[model samples]
Target chain A: MSPKTACFLVIGNEVLSGRTRDSNTQTLAHALNAQGIILSEVRVIPDIPQRIIDAVTECRARFDMVFTSGGIGPTHDDITTACVAEAFGVALRCHQESYDALNALFPEEAFNQARQKMAWLPEGSTPIKNTVSTAPGFSIGNVHVMAGVPSIFRAMVQWLVPQLEAGAPLTMCSWHAFNVYEGTFAEALTTLQGDFKTIDLGSYPFARDDKHGVALVAKGYDSHAVQEAGRALKSLLTQIGVTPISGEPAP
Target chain B: MSPKTACFLVIGNEVLSGRTRDSNTQTLAHALNAQGIILSEVRVIPDIPQRIIDAVTECRARFDMVFTSGGIGPTHDDITTACVAEAFGVALRCHQESYDALNALFPEEAFNQARQKMAWLPEGSTPIKNTVSTAPGFSIGNVHVMAGVPSIFRAMVQWLVPQLEAGAPLTMCSWHAFNVYEGTFAEALTTLQGDFKTIDLGSYPFARDDKHGVALVAKGYDSHAVQEAGRALKSLLTQIGVTPISGEPAP
Candidate 1:
C-alpha cells in the first residue's frame, strides 16, 4: 500500500516561547508511524488567527490528513477553533453535545459560563470523543483537531487513528559496531544506499569512551529486502575489518 | 528591558517527512534563552521555495529576530539562499569571501566542484563565520540563516547571538512537594499566582507510586520578586497541612 501523508499544526505561543516543551509532536509522529501514515510536516504558530487559518488551509490542501493541537481553551488566545472554521469556510457555533458533556462534568455555577467556550465548534464538524476530558475534540474535513496537553492529545489521537485508513508500514532494521569511525564506513554505506534504490540507509555516529561506532539503519517497506540488505551490510562491515554485534534481528 | 522575541524557520523536506528529528529548533531555543532572547515560533516547511519565502517574510515582520535553519546544503533541494534573497528583494550571487573560505577548507578541486553551492549568498548579506564548516551562514536584516546539521547550526547560533541585542534573561525558580495532592494545593497555588503579578507561575501535576503532587515553577526577570513569591508559596503550602520538603524554603 502507498504511504499516507499527514501534517501537524501546533498552535501555541507557549511552545514557541520555550515556556512549554512540546511532547505532542513526538506523540503524533510515533502514533502516525505505527499506523503506517507518514507525518510529513510540523508547523508551530502563535495564537494568531490568520497564521492558524493559513497553515491549516495549506496543510489540508497538501496532505491526506492534517492534525492540529492546542489553542482550544477558554482564554483570549484560544482562537484555533474559530480560525479552523474560517479556513474551511464554515460558521462557528456551539456544539450542544459538547456543552451537555461539559455541563455534566462540573457544577452549574462553575461550568455554566466559563466552560461553554469549550463547546464552540465549527459548522459540520464532528466531535472526536475525549475519554479524559469532557470538552470533546472535533474533526472537520480530513483535519482532526485535538488538545495541546500531551496526555489528552495522546488519548484523542489513539481514538481517532483507528477511524482512518492506514497504508503499509515501513520496515526498518539496524546493525551496530563499536570502536569504528564514521569515515571508515561512509564509503561502503553510500555505495549500499545507492545499490538499494528503495531502501534508505542512515549512518548515525555516537560518542563513546573507547567504544565509538556507527549505527547503520536500513529502512524500507519490504521486510525480506531489508533483512537481506542488512546481511549484506554485516558482510561488508566484516570485510572492512569492523566487528559486528550479534543479536536477533528486530521485527 | 522588554524580553526580545525571535522565531525559527526550519526549511527541509527531510524534516517534514520525519526522516530527520529536528535538533536545530531546540538548540536555538536553548541558546537564545541563555542570551535573553525568547524564541516565539518555529515553522518547518518543505523545500518548496514559495513556502520558504512566505514563512521568512511573515516571521521577519512579526518577531524582533528571525532565524532560519536548514536548506543550505550542496544538493539541489537547497533553495533557502535564493528564497531568502527573494524575500528581501535582493539578488542571489556567489560570495567571494565564502568561496575563498571554502577553498581554504578543501583543495580547489573538491571545493570548486562539490562545495561551490556553499558560496551562494543573498546580495548585501553578511556571512556568519562557521567555525565547524566552510559553508558560512548569513544574516539579512533581522533574519539569521544557518545550516541544518546540529553541530554546525549550534556553532552558528552561538556566534550569532552575541552579535545581536539581548534583553534581560528571565530567572526561574521551582518548588516541589511530595505526597501532596493537587486538589489540596490547587487553591493555595492559585492564590499565590494571583498575588505575584510579575511572576509567571506554572503548576505541573505528576503521579508517583499512586501519590499525587505538583511542581510549582515561578519565572520572571526579577530574581528578588521570584524569591519573595516563592516564600509565600512555601508558607501557604505549610498552612494547608502539607509538610515542607528540604529546600522548600526560598533560596
Candidate 2:
C-alpha cells in the first residue's frame, strides 16, 4: 500500500515572532515516520483565524492526516479550536464529557471561565486524552488539534497514533564520504539515481569538527533496493578515491 | 518603521522524509530577528515544482522578502531555481557571471552537465556569492535562493543581510517562575497583556532539570515597554508565591 501522507501545522504567534522555537514539528515528523506515515509538509503559522482555517482546510484535503500543535490553551491567543470548527463548517460546542473531566481534575476554586475554555471542541469530533494534562485535544475528520505544550502534545500523539492506519515503513542506508565535495560526485550520484528510480537519494553536506563531508542517503519502501543503492553510492565514492564510511560523519 | 516581514521556504524531500532535520529555519529565524526583520512563516515543503512555485509566489507577495533554502544543488532533485523562476513569471537564464565563476573553480575534466546546472537562474536576478562553494545562489524579485548547507546558507545570508533595509530591532525579556503553572498566572498575564498593547506576551510550559514551570516572555519594538512588561510579569509571579528567574530556566 502507498504510504499515508500527513502534514503538521504549528500555530503560534510566538513561533513566528521568534520568541518560541517550535520543536513540535520535529517531534511529529519523527513520530509519524516511525509509524509509517509520510509527513510531507510542516508549516509554522501564526494565531490568525483566517490563516488557521485556510491551512487546516487545505491540508486536510491535500494529505491523509493533519496534526496541529498550539493555540488550544485558555488564553485570548488560543483560537485554534474555533478556527478549526469554522474550517470544517462545524459549530463549536462545549463537550460535556470534557467539561466533567476537567471539573474533576481541578479544584473547584481553580475551575473558572478560563479553564472552561478547554472543554470547547468542534461538533462531531472525539477527544484525544492528554495524560500530561487533564484538558483533552480533539480529532475532527482528518485534523487532530493538540495542546502547544510539548509534554501534552506528545502524550496526546502517543495515545492517538496506534488507532490510525499505518503504511509500510521506509528502509534507509547511508554512506558518509569524508573530504568529499558534492561537485566531485554530482555526476555519479545523478547516474545512480537514474539507475535506481525507486530509491530516493539525498546528499547532505556538513562542515563540522573542522572537517567537511557529504552524507549520501538512500531510502525506499524496499529494503533490498535501499541497500543496493547504498552499495552503489559507496562504490562511486571509492572510484573517486574517497573512502566511504557507513553512517553519518562525526560532528 | 515597522519590521519588514519575511517567510522562509525550505524545499527538500529529505527533510519531509525525516532523513534530515532542518536547522536552516531556526538559523534564518534568529538571523532575521537580529536584523530586525519579522519572519512570519516557515514552510518545509517537498521538491515538487508546483508546491515550491506556489509557496514562493504566495510568500513573496505576502511578505517584504522570501528566503528559500535547498533544492539548488547539482542533481535531478535540484529544481528550486527553476521553480522560483516560474513563480516570478520569468525564464531560467544561464547566468553568465556564475557560469564563468563555476568554470574557473572546477577542473576542465570535472566540469560536467550536472555541475553546470548550478549556473541557471531566473532572468533579472543577481547572484549571491557562496564562499563555501563555487555555485552561486541568486535573488529575483523579493526572493533569495540559498544553499541548503548550514555553513553556506549562513554565509550567503551574512553577505546579503547588509544590503537589505532592516526594521526596528525588537527588545525582549523573560521570566521563569519555578513551580508556576499557566493557570496560576493566567488572569494576571491577561491583565498585563491588556496594559501593554504593543508588546507580545508568550507563556511557555517547560519541563527540564527535574522541574516543571512556565516561562513568560514579553517582547516589543519599544525597549521601555518590554522592560515594563517584564517587571510586571515578575511582580505577578511573586504575588502568586513563586520567585521568577530573570531568564530562561536551566535545561
Candidate 3:
C-alpha cells in the first residue's frame, strides 16, 4: 500500500534571515518515518501572512496530513494562527477550553492580552496540548499548528503522530568502507539498484579521520529486500577489493 | 531598497529520510543574507523527478533566482540534471567544457560512464566551478544547480554569489535579559514594534544556566533604525526591572 504522506510547513523569519538553524524539520522527518508516514515536502517560509496562507493552503490540499512549526508564540511576529484561519476562510475566535487551560496555568495578573492571544484559534479547530508551556497549539482540518521552539515542536509531534493513519514503516541497512572512492563502485552499485527495484539506494561520500570513503544505504518497506540489497552491496564491495564495514562510520 | 529574493530547492532522499542533516541550507542562508539577497523560501524535497520538476518550475517562476542543492552526483540516484531539463522543457546534453574538465582532473583509466554523467547539463546551462571536486555544477536560466556535499556546495555558492544581483544588506542589533519571560515584555515589545514599523522585531525566549530570558532582535535595511529599536528594547527591559545583556548568552 502507498504510505500516507505529510508536508511540514516551517514558518519563521528567524530561519529565513539566517538567525536560526531549523531543527524541527529534521525532528519531524525522523518521527514521521518511524510512524510509517512519508514526509513528502518541507517548506520554510517567513512570518508573512500571505506567504503562510499560500503554503498552508497548498500543503493542506496536497498532503494527507499537514504540520506547521513556528509563529505560534505571543509576539508581534506570531501571525500563524490568524493566517491559517484566513487560509481556511474561517474566523479567528478564542477557544474556550484553551483559554480555560491558559487561565488555570497562569496567574490572573499575568493573563494579559498578548498572552491571551495564545488562546485564539480558527473557528471549528481543536487545540493540540502543549506540555512544555501553558500556550497550546491548535489543529484546523488536517493542519496541526505547533510551536517554533524545538522542544515544544517535538512534543507536539509526539502527541499528533498517533492520531494519523500509519503505513508500512521503512527499514534500512548500510555498508561503509574506508579508503574507498565512489567512482570505483558507481557502476556496480547502479547495476545492483536495477536488480532490486523496490529498494532505494543512496551513496554518500565522506572524508573523515584522514580517510575518504562512501556509505551505501538501502532502504525500503520490506526488511527482506533491504537485507538482500545490503548483502549484494557487501559482495559488490568485496568484488572491488574493499573491506566493508557494517553500520555507519564513527564520527 | 527592496532586496532581490531567491528560493532554495534542497533535493535529496538522505535528508528527507533523516539519514543526513542538511547544512547546505543554513550555509546558503547566511551567505545570501550577507550578499543582501532575501532568501524568501526554502523547500526540501526528496529526489523524485515530478516533485523536483514541480519545485523547480514553481520556484523559478516565483523568485528572482532559484538555487538547488543535491542529486547532482555521479550515482544512479543523481537525476537532477535530467529533471531540471524537463522542468524548463529543454534537452539535456553533455557540456564539452565540463567533460574536458572532468577528464583532466581524474585519471583517464578512472573515467567511466558514471563519472561522464556529471558533464550532462540542460540546454544552454553554463557550468559552475567546483574547487573541492572536479565535477562542475550547472546553472540554467535563473536556477543554479549545486553539489550536495557541504564543502563543495559552499565553494560553488561562493562562485555564484558574485554573479547575482545584490540588494540592500539587512542589519540587526540584539539585547538579552535573564530572569525575564515573554509575558513580562510582550506588551512593551508590541508597542515598540508599532513605533518602529520599518524594523522587524523578533522575540526568542530561552532557558539557560538556571535562568529564563528572551532575546530581542531588531533587523532592517536601516542601521540607525535597528540601533533605535535596540535602545528601546533595552529601556523596556530596564523598566521591567532586568538589566539587558548585549549579545547572546554563553553556552
Best by DockQ: 3
Best by TM-score: 3
lDDT of each: 0.74, 0.85, 0.88
Candidate 1 has an lDDT of 0.74
Write out fnat for all predictions, comma-separated.
0.22, 0.48, 0.60
Q: Which residue ranges in model 1 land beyond 4 Å of their true spot?
A: A179-188, A208-213, A222-225, A228-236, A244-251, B1-5, B11-24, B34-38, B45-155, B167-251
Candidate 2 docking quality: incorrect, acceptable, medium or high: medium
Q: DockQ of all candidates, in order? A: 0.23, 0.58, 0.72
Position A128, candidate 2: lDDT: 91
- Name the runs in model 2 displaced over 4 angstroms: none
Task: Give one digit per residue, the lDDT tens place, for model 1 in B99-131.
Answer: 877777765544534357678889889998889
State the DockQ, from 0 to 1, for candidate 1: 0.23
Off by over 4 Å in 3: B208-211
| Least well predicted 10-residue stretch by lDDT in candidate 2 chain A | A17-26
Query: Candidate 1 falls in which docking quality class?
Result: incorrect
Q: What is the TM-score of each candidate against the true structure?
A: 0.70, 0.94, 0.96
Worst 10 residues of 3 chain A by lDDT: A205-214
Candidate 2 lDDT, tens digit per residue, B117-183?
8998889999998998879999988999999988899899888876888777777899997776677
Using TM-score as the measure, name the better of candidate 1 and candidate 3. 3
